[model samples]
Target: MNGPHDMGGMHGMGPIPIEADESVFHSQWEAKVFAMSFATFCNYFPVDETRHASERMPPGDYLTSSYYERWLYALELLITEHNLVTPEEIEQRIAKLSQEEY
Candidate 1:
């Protein structure tokens, strides 16, 4: 039942910091996926045509943001759109994790 969208957080993987050029791909599908994932992580709706405007999230905000924060946000959008994970489950999991020590 789990998929890329189901992967709520990067956890121990740390930040997958993507650069502008490195982010772009020759294949349109790859580009779309990257854009979608990035936008989703940033808690922004994905837009196909206007990627520049869509991904124009604040700068320092990104630096301050955790990898898991970005991943969780994106997964939230993807799961909702694809009917993968329920909001109740998301909340429950988050609550459970919050009780644990880092």
Candidate 2:
């Protein structure tokens, strides 16, 4: 497979940056993404497909996205692809939530 997931030893990629004292999740949503991915995997989705989502992503995005972001991206793709939810439904939900009073 020529996907980004197979790009381990290829050249031209810069060195991995080591963050100093990095927390597990950069934001609350990232933690939620992790949990969502895990829940989906446990229920109906395949873990390999989730991992392969990163590979299937556009090359630039795959290269630039964070680990958890990749997981989140995978979760979104799988949910839509599997007919669990539609993109429009998710967007509407987000819009409704954004307009709600806290």
TM-score of each: 0.34, 0.85
Q: How many backbone clashes does candidate 2 have?
A: 0
Q: Candidate 2: misplaced stretches above 4 Å?
A: 100-102
What is the per-residue lDDT of model 2 for residues 12-48, given as tens digits with 9 covering 90 to 100? Answer: 8778788899899889889998888898988987767
State the local distance difference test value for candidate 1.
0.52
Best by lDDT: 2
Question: Residue 80 of candidate 1: its Cα lDDT?
Answer: 62
lDDT over C-alpha atoms for residue 28 of model 2 = 88
Best by TM-score: 2
- Cα lDDT tens digits for candidate 1, 3-97: 33233663664766667765335455455556657665456444442233222324444445544444444455566656767888879977997
Model 2 error, position 70 (Å): 1.0
